[model samples]
Target chain A: MHRTLHPLTSLCFILFFFVIALFGAPTTQMVGVMILLSAASSIRKRKQAWKKIALYILPIGILLFLVNSAFGAPFSRGLAYALRFVLLITPLVIVLLGGSPTDFRLGLRTVPIPSRLHYLFIFSFEIIQSLRDVFQAVYIGQQLRGYNANRSLGNKWKNIFPLLLPVMLIAISQGLDRSLAFEFKGIESPAEKIYLRTLTLSPFDKLSIAILLLSSLGLIVASFILP
Target chain B: MITIKDLSFRYKQEARNSFEHISLHLQDGQALGVIGPSQAGKTTFAYALAGLLQKHFRGGSLTGTVIFDAQDQAPGTSEIGFVFQDASLQLSGVTETVEEEIAFSLEQFGVPRDIMRERIEEQLSTFHLIGLRYRHPKTLSGGETQMLAIASEAAKHPRLFILDEPTQALDADHVRHLIDFLRVAKRSSTIIFIEQNMSATFELCNHVLFLENGRQQFLGTPHDLLNSNIDVSSLTLPELIDVQRSLGRNHISLLFKETIEWMKKCRTSA
Candidate 1:
């Protein structure tokens, strides 16, 4: 049976990779983790994930290489940072593919975060959920209104100001409306909130976390002793 | 049931009050159609009734007792389901998929997972949105989003349901569906139906609350508003309502099919 792991498990795994990227030697182990994580994301999500990595990571990584090489730093040093960036991002993509926003929030709620911040986290997802579509509609609306987006770079830059303002205004106004919606829905009730998705640390989850932490600790020891 | 006495509200930034001394008494299961020109304070009135004026919009100055039964419920609670004019505003926006959006309100109300699933499916099919169940609600067209908002609110089955221009983004077919939806809803819920267009309200509503310059000009039945000497050009009815009115029919429905049947009956009776 395909049992879904708890969201906190992925979160903890992601934190482990962050630690690895920070402390571990720039070795084949990091590369292996990167490859495994990137591949583990479902094909449908990985398609978009790869696009983001290509668009953002490739440019930043190449830029770092150039800047470091220009400053007389070893080319491999810049490559290490690029790989570290990959380590930081891959687990995030895995979590997005494997888990959901609700699970993520519920998992966060398990942590000792402030109540206001927790509320903000939940409220923000709501805004993003609708604002994304509203922004698209605004773009289409502008196009239909004869303001084409596919113009010269200078013209496109000019259009961005107007486009951005309406999108922001719509988002802000709709956000206020959604706050009211939350109130009407009893989301902000002083009453205790019941989370439907139980966040149990399954035996597999415990085993996975233990294995992940041990591997990172072993890597840390090896990095210092091998040198 | 709701009772609003001596209600006067003014936005902190505005030069004048949105509405003043607006007293209303809505009995259980009564559907009141609020019609007026632009800036008639229909929305403000809705906010006041929903207890949004003071509770949510804190900067505003509001005076009056807007009471719902002896229970004295707080403003904007689960008892009132408001579908705002901008349909997107009505959406909770927290859920990823349309199905989740429809169920978000129910989840907040602490509904069982199984029932939430059932109602989500039922709403999806009822709103003809079964195909878009997995799609992001924010990515939907205006009509689809509006339908989602309505379905989401209806799923909770709140006692006082307020819809502000719910059909503004919808087509005639969807408007018909809404009227049918309201037909069933009115048997239990009190409806505060606000619309610039008088189309679906003619069938879905019983009482009318006509406002002008934020004053209660008339509060009576749909038939009374049609028969009374009120200039309704500003209300913006579809062409069919204008034609039916021109033909001396006091009771005109925006639903073309129903209007056609009514016309046939009138001709045969004559």
Candidate 2:
């Protein structure tokens, strides 16, 4: 019952807009895809998550529009481009707000990267995991050692330094050994090259891709017609 | 096929020598088990012997003769391939599949494409890891990871194989598999199996060296140390030794056989 999204899919969700924009996709299509992704992610608690994104985005979007009008570089183009940026930003906010760490892990797994760079890629996440452990270990150790950590600024600040060094050292030593263990198991120095599994372009994905393509073509057509 | 005399080294910042007055000789096809308590310089000794500590990690004055195959050797070209205690740390590949793990090493060794493919298949089945070839090592259990480590190392047949506590994280079944692999490899290569697992020491060691507090406590056959029971408190041993002692069977062959029989009985009962 514990379903997890693949790391590749998470990555795709985050970067799909960037890819679209890079490939000269249109703003409305990008916006539509981003909204779709964000909406999908926020399904469980749609209003709360979606509301937060809108609040943060709406103000900046208005400011950008105002600036574009003042400078006046093709109002439609500016609007489209500004919308494209918004599309790119929404998934990240949704991912950060709505997704669990497991989602990020799944996203990494789904990354369409080359095999040779896999360890390096995974290692970056491992470093973050270790850092998170370091904090939790230190906090637990502090609690066990009878350091009272009440909900007060001064008291919390006082306990910080006393617990910091020991935790850091323990975490560093353990992390090194763990990293070495990872290498020992042939994870660090694999014997073969591997490639990401070929992506099956589903109807949804194809629809998304086609919309992006057509949106880009429409932008080109609109420029010619207007001129 | 390794000779070291008057070898000594000190880390860059540390005042005391990591190793000093170290002299040893290992013959081809001979297996030597290195034993020591935690941080008692077992890894340091192995690293020095393999020329990794001196060459890569540590920098210090070392005045000694390390003659590999009776030839004067430089650092980093050591024929000894090392597998450290932590199987997870030793792996450096990014792929999720077992095939990639073995193939990565073979590629590093510069084996040709056709030979690499053949060797990959051979090792996959040899290590009994063919079923999990497409699985990521991270998803594997501890024993499977250990097996993968050995399998990857086995892909590269080094002249002198140095394994540091190779079976520490493995279960009995996987440990037995590793011992079997080492025993087979011993036919051609000299093994320097550094471990705290005394049962494995007794089972596979032709010779054993006990180190404590950065000093060599005893060096002889397993029977000598197990029988004498002197100056070995610093060295770690398997729990079965204590069990056999309680069973009052200190006889070398009887103690060993009894431990195996007892393990078998437990397995069957379970």
Global lDDT of each model? 0.77, 0.67
B101-123 per-residue lDDT for model 1 (tens digits): 88777766778788877888888
Q: Give the least accurate 10-residue stretch of model 2 chain A, judged by summed lDDT.
A: A190-199
- State the lDDT of candidate 1 residue by residue for A94-168, as single tens digits: 667656665666566566765447767777666674567777898889889998878999988988678878989
User: lDDT of candidate 1?
Assistant: 0.77
lDDT of 2 by residue, A1-227 (tens): 12343444445556655555444346445556556554645455556666765687766766776677565577766666566666667666665655565345334434566443655666676667656767887788778888788759987997788777887787677666655444323343433433223234446645655565565566556655754
lDDT of 2 by residue, B90-197 (tens): 665344578877766665445667877777787887778889998977788877887887777777676778888888888887788788888889988888999888
Error of 1 at A225 (Å): 9.0
Off by over 4 Å in 2: A1-82, A87-122, A147-227, B74-80, B112-132, B226-230, B236-270
**Which candidate has the top score in lDDT?**
1
Could you tell me the TM-score of candidate 2?
A: 0.67
Chain A TM-scores, per candidate, are 0.67, 0.55
Give the Cα error of residue A5 in candidate 2, in Å.
17
> Which 10 consecutive residues of model 2 chain B have the lowest summed lDDT?
B73-82
